[model samples]
Target: MQAWSMTDVGKKRRENQDSTYVKLDHERNMALLMVCDGMGGVNGGAEASRIACEEFARSVWDTLSGKISGKEAVALLEKGVSAANMEVYTSAISDPSYMGMGTTLTAALIVGEDAYVINVGDSRAYHLKRRAKDKLKQITDDHSVAGDLFRKGSITKEQYDTFPDKNIITRAVGTDPQVYGDVFELKLDKGEVLMLCSDGLTNMVPDMAIEQVLKTSETPADACQTLVDMANRAGGKDNISIVVFIKD
Candidate 1:
């Protein structure tokens, strides 16, 4: 089991409001990966992401033990997200500066041969099977205006790329009293890869290019650095963060 995570304040952003967490249980071949992208003013955004990422990771770690069933894993992931949302929402209400702070969260838990995922807002989860060719599957849906338009076939890929409101997300954690996460369960055979990332990478790097790097990179660390570098080269415009793990 191997995992790597990286975060960068992109060329155009004054601060990096992205946060990530990775916990690997080598003995059990289990790993937990999470990424959060915050939206708000400088302080609010950063704080929101930090709180959400930490709370979720901590909650899961507290209860995670040896082997478990798929159903139990999904319930634990849901509980973690709920705990994170409540903490962020509470902090937002308590502080005037963070009144409207919120963040997008994408989390994946890899246990044995299966991966359980949960997502809120625009951050995403992706899967790539080592034996498959050119098949990089996106596992989460974006809760943003442009994302909705593109999914509904109301807009072309070109239009979505240039959409003025592309950055405006419709759903987020900590923005309201309650937030629901989308959950998914998938298999992760040996040598397969699972990734969680903020929008900075997706917005700047095309999916095909991302798939190419994942296919060619030798290790999770290499893939992470290469992707971040590529995003910067493509005119990094936001905070970029990625978490990648491979079942070796």
Candidate 2:
């Protein structure tokens, strides 16, 4: 597996509230990718994102260090996220300054040809599989108000685009005392790619555009840079973070 990641303070945002981490455990043939988009005013958002990512990564590394099965590793990942959520929530409650601080988390762990995905809030995980010479498929869903409205048939494609609160997430880590994340597993082939990104990239670049770029790019780093460039060209309204992993 090959991994590439980057985070940028977009054209508009004064602070980069997004955080990302990617690590490969060669001995276990496992790779981990995590992205978090924090929410709050001033530096609180960035702090929350940093804390969530660091705690989650530390917990996962510690829990999975022993000889554990793949299923057990997956369970450990969930527990790590839950622990991070509680820590963030408790800290925010104790400190009135970070009262409403929260963050969206999406993580992916790849072992052999199988990948496990877990997500909370609107940050996304996408699986890009080559169907033909020029076709790629995206296998993930956004968890936002606009996504819900679109799913419920209450909003059309145009309405989703024009929705004022499209960035408002219905659920997020640290927002509630306990956070539940959606988990998924995927079987990957040689040419498959897994992308984990904050809403900044998705809100600016459409899924089809992402597929095209991933299909055209020669490497994971190139794909990640191209996506970031495309998002910036499309107004760059928020902080952007992206991680791309390709099966070798």
Candidate 3:
């Protein structure tokens, strides 16, 4: 397996409130990938994303051992999300400046031939088959108002694209006392790629353009850098983050 990740503050953002993580264990045929995008006032956004990402990764690292099963991988990722959410929530309530801080968490755990994915808020995971002509498959659902409206047929595609409150996410990692993440499992075959990214890239670049990059890039690192450049070139209104893993 091979993995690569990148995060950028973008053109307009004052600071980068995005965090990412990637770990690969060849001996065990395992990998972990994560991306987080924070929201709040002052420095709370950055702090929230940093803490949540670290705590979530720590939780998984502490319990993950040799030869994990699909069920076990799911449990570990779920626990990691819970741990991250609690840590962020505690920090938010304890500090006055971070009272309402929250962040999106999208993660994937690859063990053997299966990948277990967990997500909250709007960050996403996508699956692309290297040898097939299939279109990119988004693995997670957005938890924002516009996403919900569009999914439920309450809003047309054109209206969703222009929705003013599209960025307002309904569910997040640390906004509530307790949080749950949506879980999904998929097969990860050789030469296939799985990507985890923040809305920064999605909001700026359309899916078709992103698919083109993933399909043509020579390597995961190149794809990451190219995607970041593309997002920045397209106005870069938000902090951008991307993490990719290829089953080699």
Candidate 4:
């Protein structure tokens, strides 16, 4: 497995509030990709995101280094997320400057031909599988309030298009002491691609556009840049971060 990642402040945002990490345990055939989008006032957002990513990476690395089964790896990922949440929550409470700081997290771990996905808040993990006619299909759901409203038929297509606060997420890490995340396991095949990104990219570009760019790009790095460029062209309203992974 191979991974590439990129981050941009975007056209409108003055600072990047997003952070990402990609780690590959080649000897164990394990690969991990994590994306975090922070929320707060001023620098608080960036700090929250940085802390979450760093803590998660450290916890995962330490836990996976010990003797454990594949299932244990999944559990460790969840534990790492919980630890990160507590760490951020405590920091926010202790420091007046970082009050109410929070962040959305989404991660993917690849072991052999299987992929494990963990998500908190609106950050997304997408699996693109090739289909007939050389097409690709997306295999993840957005976790935003807008997404829920769209699914429940409460919001029409026109309303969704113009809806304010469309990026508002219903769940996030560090918002509360206890955070629950969605976990998924899937089988990976040759030519399949996994994308983990902040809402900034998704808010500006649709799934089809993402598929088109990834399909045409020569490498994951190019695909990531194309996506960022497209988002900035479409009016980048927030910090953008994305990681693209290809399974060999």
Candidate 5:
């Protein structure tokens, strides 16, 4: 497998509040990827994402130290998300400067022929394959007001696109004493691509455009860089982050 990741402070953001991580183990044939998009006042957002990522890495490292079954892998991803939430929540309450800090968390774990994913807030993961027209599939759902409305059939596709509060997420790490993440499992195959990214790229560039870039880019790293550059070119409205892994 091969992987690549990149994060950038877009044109409109004063500071980048996104954090990413990627771990590859050739011997074990395993890979881990994560993306976090932060929200809060001033310095709070940046620190929240940094703290969440650090906590997530520690939990993943400890839980995935040895070979684990599919059941254990699912449990491990949940633990990682919970650990990150607690770390950010505790820090936010303990310090006045970080009173309302929170962040979106999305992770991808690929081991053997299986891939596990966990998500909170609005950061997402996508599955891309070499296929006919529709090559990119969004693997996670947004945890936002707009998302909920759409799921309940209260909003139409046209309305969802113009929803005024689409940016307001209903669930997030560090926002409450207890937080839960949506977990998923996928059966991966050779040459398939799994991408984890912050809302920066998704919000600025549509899914169709993302597919075009992923298909045209020559390498994993090139695809990642191209995604970031494309988002920036489209009047970058937020911090952009991209992490992708290709099963070989």
Candidate 6:
């Protein structure tokens, strides 16, 4: 297994509210990748994203503290996500400055030949494979109004481009007492590629363009830099974060 990740503050943001993590379990052959985009004021947004990334990854590691199956891995991720939400929510309510602090979290766990994805809010996960014609297969759905409209077929592609609420996420970590994350499982082939990213990359670059980068990059790190650069070139309106991994 191999991976690369990057986070940027973007052109307009004074500070970055994005965070990411990547770790590999050599013994169990489990790889974890995550990205978080925070909300609230400056300190709150940064802190929220930091807590979610650290807590969620640690909780997941603890849940699989022992041996687990693919199904159990998925359940563990769900439990970890809920725990992370509670942690953030409790922290937000405890402090005055962090009143409405929250964040979007997207994670992927690859064990052996199976991969599991979990997401909340607007951050996303994707799967790419050469056998799939070099298309970026989006694995997570954004928990936002635009996402809902796009999914329900209520909005046309052209309409979605101009639709508002694209950034108004319906669900988020730390915004409520509880938040449920969506989990998906897939079979990972040797050359399959996975990406976990914040809205920064998607909002700036189209999927087709992203797919081209994934296909042409010589290394995962190169792709990571390329994506960040692309987003920065496209006006860099928000904090950017990306994690790219490949099954080897």
lDDT tens string, model 4, 1-248?
77899999999888899999998877787788999999997888998999999998888865666445669867977988998899889999999999999999888878778888888888888877644345555455666788789879999967875679787788888988899788888888887888999988988998778888877777889999999999999999888899999887
Query: Which residue runs of candidate 6 sit more than 4 Å off their true CA positions?
Result: none
lDDT of 6 at 13: 91
lDDT of 3 by residue, 160-222 (tens): 877899899999989898999999999998888899999999989888888888888888999
Q: What is the lDDT of residue 244 in candidate 4?
A: 94
Q: Taking the tens digit of each residue's C-alpha lDDT, what string does model 1 give over 75-133? A: 99989989999999999999998999999999998889989999999999999986645
Sort by lDDT, best first: what order? 3, 1, 5, 6, 2, 4
Residue lDDT tens for model 2, 143-163: 789989998999998898779
TM-score of 1: 0.97
Residue 112, model 1: Cα distance from true site in angstroms: 0.5
Q: In model 2, which regions exceed 4 Å deviation?
A: 66-70, 131-138
Question: Mind giving the per-residue lDDT tens digits that candidate 6 earns over 1-248?
Answer: 88999999999899999899999887878888999999996599889999999999889975676567877888888987888899899999999999999999999888888889999998999889956466789999889999899999999877776676689999999999989999999988887889999999999988888898888887889999999999999999998899999888
**What TM-score, over all chains together, does every model reach?**
0.97, 0.93, 0.97, 0.93, 0.97, 0.96
Candidate 1 stretches with Cα past 4 Å from truth are none
- Separately for all candidates shown, the number of backbone clashes (residues 3 or more apart, or on different chains) is 0, 0, 0, 0, 0, 0
Off by over 4 Å in 3: none
Alpha-carbon shift of residue 208 in model 4 (angstroms): 0.8
Backbone-clash count (model 5) = 0
Local accuracy of candidate 5 as per-residue lDDT tens digits, 1-248: 99999999999998999999999998898988999999998888898999999899889865677677888888888889889999999999999999999999999888888999999999999998856565799999999999999989999977987799888999999989889999989988887889999989988888888898877777889999989888999999999999988888
**Better candidate by lDDT, 1 or 4:** 1
Which consecutive 10 residues in model 2 have the weakest lDDT in total?
A: 131-140
Best by lDDT: 3
**Cα-based RMSD of the predictions, in order?**
1.2, 1.8, 1.0, 1.9, 1.1, 1.3
Estimate the overall C-alpha local distance difference test score of candidate 3: 0.92
